[model samples]
Target: MVKRNIISVLDMKDDMPQLVELAEKLKKERGNHGEPLRGKTLAMIFEKPSTRTKISFDVAMSELGGHPLYLSARDMQLDHGETVEDTARVMSRFVHGIMYRAFDYKMMDRLGDSATVPVISGLDNLEHPCQALADMLTIKEHLGSFKGKKLVYLGDGNNVCNSLLYACAIMGVDMIACCPAVRMPNAEIMLGAARIADQNGSKILASHEPLEACVDADILYTDTWVSMGDSTSEEVAVKIFKKYQINQELLDIAKPDCIVMHCLPCHRGQEITDDVIEGPHSVVFDEAENRLHAQKAILLTLLK
Candidate 1:
């Protein structure tokens, strides 16, 4: 069998909806589901620090009766000049799968190309497919369906936004990435997702006006303006992103039932406000919890 690698959201392709359904099933079964990966092991390599990505993948592996081995890049020979391809070749011999959270997308792609077994992207500079999966699950759970829903993302066009574009496009959900012109998502990714969205009967749009983008939106999403390893200073980012914050005013512009979301480590006063994230319409925690179930589904699909 040919090995599968989820280096990008498009890799899931037609399997995305099925994976979301599987995630829902796993969530409900929880501890009742028997071990399917009893003797398997997943090697998790981290080149960047993470809270949700680390804990969620670790817990997901344990819940499925699989072992997760955490490896910090700094502690490995990779830090001292070992190539990612060599590390991937070595790790594939010992583990059933490899999950990498990398600072560089190029390195992640190299690892995926070299690995013999399934390789998953915990995150990379360009994409966060796992988080996007969880976001899809959460949207499905809360909104009941993706049919005619519109999601407006108000923040920097970072990795999270990039993956969401692919996820929304695949699921037939209309998405508008609203950010400053200078902060727009990768042009190539936007164009690719637009093509996919067109085929799915939905549309992907870019807007510099947040208020206009939020009008009639069914979901409102945002992330920190300044991400890890970002070269932009907080003071400057905050100044530019002030109008894009997901506060009560912004939420009011969207549909009355619009659910607010923020991929965590959020800057309360910057990308999102305290009251909005803690408000009745907020599903941030639920979205966070879905990470475990979504990733479990991904693991089963690739490794089982």
Candidate 2:
């Protein structure tokens, strides 16, 4: 049987066409198709604070005629030293699928390995394939296609950046990751993206300077310098990511009307400035809303 969960963008293209078609269907049938997951239960376990992932998945499951059971790490046996594999085995017997957002990618893998039913990675430390789906949908909606588009990613090379690399590579979108050396994407992930890019006529290039990446870029994107598991020290975040901020000067380097994007829950002053994020070209909120539509597509393709 085919596993239905999304763990990383790597090894993920098999269901993409189906996923995109479902996204289109969900867009048309938002007010209906409310019974797609009737009698199905989705277990949503959270290991981090979220506004979008939590709300989107809950609403998506319910709207599709499924029940979503939300649980946090602190409230589960995870706090009592329960293994994720055990949790996965148990939840599989109770729920039709499992969606978890965790601070570590390995935990999600273990859970997926043990589940009898489908397991969805709501998120993990290293990749966010769902968010990338939404971002790609938004870009396609705005640009009419993904082929040959110049997408630039500016900021710390974190999960969002890695996800974008995979998305751009898959869809033939040329991408440049502008980040400091220390914050660049993992070498293996980069190599994987590059290999895909070579086949798809896209490219994944990285540079330490922002202006170089932003040059002739059609889309400018960023994520927070520090994410959920990081130490919440303002000074440390600022110091580490000083060179990667997307400000007005960097904006000027891109096309005149280039779109700006963030994954949301942004630390405004750190990764992006107030004007750029709220500016005329910003599409961050639209990207956020697509989270609902895109993940719905993912659920249907993998679990329906």
Candidate 3:
């Protein structure tokens, strides 16, 4: 059988709903499925710092009867001299699968290309597939279906937005990417998502005005203005994104029951306000917690 990879949301196109369904089941009954991955080992390589990604994967593997070996960039030779392909090939012999959170998107591709086992992208500069999975599951829990709801993403059109665009397209949810034109998502991803959206009867919109995008939105989402490997100063990014903050005023423009979401490590007062993040409308913690269940579904799908 061909080894599958979850390097981007596009990778889960046909299996999106299946994964979400599995995630929901796993959430409600964590131990319903006996450990399918007993004695298996997963190698997690982190080229960047993390809180949720690291702990969630570790716990997910443990709960699934697998071991997760956390390897930082400093712990691995990839930073000093080794090539990603060699690292992947070497680890494939010892581990059941590999999950990598890195800066370069191509390195994840290289690992997938070289490794005999499954390769999962925890996060990269281009896309974040796992986060999108959790986001979809969370939306499903709240809104029942994606048929009529609109998800408005505000702030820098970075990796999270890119994956969300793909997820929304595959799941038939209308999505409006609300960000400055200069900070629009990758053109190739937009083109691909647009194709999928067009065929599925879901609209993919890009708007510069937050109010225009948030109008009647069922979900309002945002991410950090400056990401893990981003070089832009917080000061600069804050200024550029000051107008895009998701606060009460912005929430007023959306549906009365609109839910707030952030793929966390939020810059509280910058991309979102403290009140909104801690308010009754926020489900950021649910999104964070679903990471474990959603990723367990991913692991079972790819590894079992």
- Candidate with maximal lDDT: 1
* TM-score for candidate 1, residues paired by index: 0.99
lDDT order of candidates, top first: 1, 3, 2
Residue-by-residue lDDT tens digits, candidate 3, 1-304: 7799999998899899999999999899887667888898989999988999999999999899889999988888883698877888889999999999988998888888899999999999999999999999999998899887899999999999999999999999999999887789888888889899989999898888997788888999999999887899989898788888999998998899999999999999999999999998999999999999999999989888
Q: Model 3 Cα RMSD, Å?
A: 1.0
Which regions of candidate 1 deviate over 4 angstroms? Answer: none
Can you give the lDDT of residue 219 in candidate 2? 90
C-alpha lDDT of candidate 1 relative to the true structure: 0.93
Per-prediction count of colliding residue pairs?
0, 0, 0
Candidate with more favorable, higher lDDT: 2 or 3: 3
| Pairs with backbone N, CA or C atoms under 3 Å apart (clashes), candidate 3 | none
Among residues 3 or more apart in sequence or in different chains, the pairs in candidate 1 whose N, CA or C atoms overlap within 3 Å are none
Relative to the unseen true structure, what is the C-alpha lDDT of residue 76 in candidate 2, on a scale of 0 to 100? 91
- Alpha-carbon TM-score of each model against the true structure: 0.99, 0.95, 0.98
lDDT of 1 by residue, 107-165 (tens): 89999999999999999989999999999999999999997999999989999999999
lDDT (Cα atoms) of all candidates against the true structure: 0.93, 0.83, 0.92
Give the per-residue lDDT digits (tens) of candidate 2, residues 87-122. Answer: 788888898888889888888888878888877777
Candidate 2 backbone collisions, by pair: none
| Winner on TM-score (1 vs 3) | 1
